[model samples]
Target: MHGHQIRRAAQVDRTELWSDVKPGSLYGALHRMQVEGVIEAVRTEQEGNRPARTIYALTSAGAAELIDHRDEALRDTKLRHDPVDLALQNVIDLGEDALRAIIVARRKALAEQLDAWLALRELAAPHIRGLEWTTFRHTELRLRTELAWHDELLDQLPKLMANQPTSMTTS
Candidate 1:
């Protein structure tokens, strides 16, 4: 697909939900893959009033790489960078007021995410088939689980901070 087409598909699939797949990163990846001879330009075509763009197709190497990456993606239990965890490590410095502010903002973001996933699931359930539907359902379930966990965290935050030194008490 062309640049705009790729971005459109990513938006439709909500790729940013599970990743940091920005347009800049996506385009950069395409260029890097092309440089590595994994993918090559196929043909350039303009659809009616649209500008001509380079179309790309995977090379044999690209297909093989894709298969290998797909396997790792399915089987690997990878740890992702969670900014919240990093912040918690410095919870001592965050003072109660600031920490509460952070938690509130995070809770709001998580709620928004949960709602987005729920809406996506509703959209996908009607059109997606078989295994794809099952995968989408699994994703929806994960989102619900995380959302619930955030509620628990919010409930326990006050107690967690109680033991930690408060800025007012320190100075």
Candidate 2:
């Protein structure tokens, strides 16, 4: 595919699971991949009034490398770091009202995102394969987990606030 074609295909990728393919970065990424011998320019074609576009095809090495990377990622067991955990660790700095407000806002955002994924899934359900469907499901599951965590934190806020130190002490 050419850069424009690749970018067009990226538009349907709501998951953004691997990498966020931005329009501006597509050409640069294609160039780099071609230079690395993972992809090659197949041919240049012009469609009437349109400018010539170089088509690219992945090399055999690229396919092998992709499989290796995918397998390695699947084998990875380390938890991804989230900045929310850091903020929660220092939750003593925020008052109960402030923490509650943050959690509420977070829940709203997560709910909105979940709604978007559901809409997309519904729209694409007829066209998508099992793996693609699972991508949507995976995102839905994560969003639900985070929303539940927020609800639980809200429920525990009173006890958490009561246990917080009234003043900071020097060591």
Best by lDDT: 2
Error of 2 at 74 (Å): 1.9
Model 2 clash count equals 0
Angstrom error at residue 67, model 2: 0.8
Q: What's model 1's overall lDDT?
A: 0.79
Best by TM-score: 2
Q: Compared to the true structure, candidate 2 yields what TM-score?
A: 0.90
Model 1 lDDT tens row, 96-124:
67877877787788778778867777877
Per-residue lDDT for 121-141 in model 2, tens only? 898889999687777788899
Model 1 lDDT at residue 16: 79
- Clashing pairs for predicted structure model 2, backbone only: none
- lDDT against the true structure, each candidate: 0.79, 0.86
Candidate 1 wrong stretches, greater than 4 Å: 17-21, 24-26, 47-49, 165-171
